[model samples]
Target: MLWDWGYALEILPVLGQAAIITIEATLLGFAMAAVLGLVFAILRMLGPAVAWPVSMLIELVRSTPLLIQIFFLYFVLPKFGVTLDAFTAGVLALGLHYATYCAEVYRAGLENIPRGQWEASIALNLSLYTTFKDIILPQAIPPVVPPLGNYLVALFKETPLLSAIAVLELMQTAKILGSETFRYVEPITLVGALFLAMSLVSAALIRQVERALGRRFVR
Candidate 1:
C-alpha cells in the first residue's frame, strides 16, 4: 500500500464538508445546554420545591451514557411516531447529555456568588426577576463561561458518535474514505488533525472570553 500525500489531500475536501456537520451539532447542543443549565441553576437556587425535579433530571441524565442516549433517540422514538433526522437526533442527544454537566457548572457559579449579594438583594426589596438578572446572573454567568465552553468543546469531540446513526461528520467521512480506499492512515490521521485544530481554535476563543471575564471579576 502506498503512503500517499495525494490521498490525504483528496479526502480533505470531503472531510471539510463533513466538519460542518460536527460544528452544527456542537453549537446547537451547546445552545440547548446553556439555556437548560441556566434554568436548572435558577430552579435549584429558588428552593427544594422548585429544584428537586430538575435536580433529579440532571442526575438521571448524568448517570446515563451519552452513547446510549443517542442510540435511544435514534432507534426508540420511531415507536412513538416521532421522527428525527440523524443530525437532529445527534444534536438533541448531545445537548441533553451535556445539559446535566452544564447545570452543575451553573450551580457552581451560583454557589460561588457571595451570600452577601443575596442578602443585599433581599434588603433592597428588589423583585426576584430584577435581583437575578441585574445582580446574580451578571456576576455568575461570566465565571461559568469557560467551564461551559469546555463542555461545548467536549460536545464537539463527541459528534463522531453521530456516525452510529449515519450523520455524516468528520470521523464518518474518514471511515467512508478508508473503506473505499483501504488506507486508513491518511484518512484517520486527517480526522485527528481536524479534531485537534477545531478544539484548539475553540479553546483559544474561550480563553479570550475567560480573560474578559477576569477583568470584570477582578474589578
Candidate 2:
C-alpha cells in the first residue's frame, strides 16, 4: 500500500464535512443535556418523594455504558416499531446519555450555592421557580462553566460511537476512506489529527469563557 500523503490531503474536505456533523451532534446533544439535566437536578433537590426515583434513574444511566444505550436505541427500538434515522438516533442517544452526567453537574452547582441564598429566597417569600430563575441559576451557572466545557469536550470525542449506528461522523468517514484506498494509516491519522485539532480549539474557547464568566461572577 502506497502511503500517499497527498491522498490524505485530498480527503481533508471530506473529513471537514464529517467534522461538522460531529460538532452539530455534540452541540445539540449538550443543549438537550443542559435543559433536561437541570430539570432532573431540580427534581432531586425538591425532595425524595419526587427525587428518589429521579436520582435512581440518573445514577442508573450514569452507571451503564453509553455505548449500550446507543445500541439499544438503534437495535431494540425497531422491535417495538419505533424507528429512528441514524442521525436522530445518534443525537438522541448521545443527548440522553450525557444528560445523566449533566444532571449531576448541575446538582453539584446548585449545592455549591450558599444556604443563605435559599434562605433569603424563602425570607422574601419568592416562589420556587422565581427563586431559581432570579437567583440560584444566575449565580450557579458561572462556576459550572469550566466543568460544562469539559463535558462538551468529552461529548465531542464520544461522537465516534455514533458510527456504530451508521452516522457518518469523522471517524466513520475515515473508516470509509481507508476501506476504499486500503490505506488505514493515512486516513486514520488524519481523523486523529482532526479530533485533536477540534479538542484543542474547544478547550481554548472554553478557557476564554471561563475567564469572562469568572470576572462577571466575582462582580
Candidate 3:
C-alpha cells in the first residue's frame, strides 16, 4: 500500500519522457560550458587588458548561486527585453555557471603545457590559431578530460535545479506526478533511483574516456 506498483508503472513512462528533457539539457549545457570555458581560458591568456575583465566576469559568476542565476535569466532578464523560455533560460544558467569552473580547469591544463612547446610553435612560425588548435588543445585537453567529465556529471546533477524554473525535467515531472496522484512515495523514490543509476553510468563513461585519452597521449 505504501508503494504502489501499479501507480509506479503508470507514471514510469511520463518520468522517462521527462528524463529525456533532463539529458538533453545536461548535454547541451555542458557542450556550451566546455566551449565557452575554452574561450574564456584563451582570452585570459591574451593580455592584461582582456584578462582583467574576463577574470572579473568569471569570479562574479562563480561567486553567485546557480538558482539566483536561473531566476535572473528566466525572470529578470525579460524586464530588459531579453526574454527566454524556461528551458532556454535554465540551460543558459547551467552553462554560464559551470563554465567558470570549466575555465579554471582549462587554465590549469593549458598552464601545464611546457614553455618549450610554446617556443617551438613560435619558432615554427605557427599562427595562433594553428598553435592552439593543432598543438595546444590536443595536448592540454587530454590531461583535463577527467576533470571536465566530472563537471559533466556535476552538471547532470544540477539539472534538477532547472525544475525551479518549471522546466519539466525529471525531478519536476516527478513532483507534478506526486501532486496529481497525492502519491509522493513512488515518484520521488523512482527519481532518486534514476539519478543514482545515471550518475554511476556517467562515472563509468568518464573512466573509459580517461583511459582512452591516456592511451592516445601515451603514443
Give TM per candidate: 0.94, 0.95, 0.99
* Cα RMSD, each candidate: 1.4, 1.4, 0.7
Q: lDDT tens string, model 3, 121-199?
A: 9999999999999999999999999999999999999999999999999999999998997999999999999999999
- Candidate 2 residues lying further than 4 Å off, grouped into runs, are none
Each prediction's whole-model lDDT (CA): 0.88, 0.89, 0.96
What would the per-residue lDDT of candidate 2 be over residues 1-219, giving only the tens digit for each residue? 456778878998998999999999999988988788888988988877999899888888888998898888888999999998888888888888888888888988999999999999999999999999999999888888888888889988999999988899988898998889787888788889889998999999999999999888786
Clashes of each: 0, 0, 0
Poorest stretch of ten by lDDT in candidate 2: 1-10
Report how far residue 31 has shifted in candidate 3, in Å. 0.3
Q: After best superposition, candidate 3 residue 51: deviation in angstroms?
A: 0.4
* lDDT for residue 213 in candidate 3, whole number 0-100: 89
> What TM-score, to 2 decimals, does candidate 2 have?
0.95
The C-alpha stretches of model 3 lying farther than 4 A from their native spots are none
Task: For model 1, give the 10-residue run with minimal summed lDDT.
Answer: 1-10
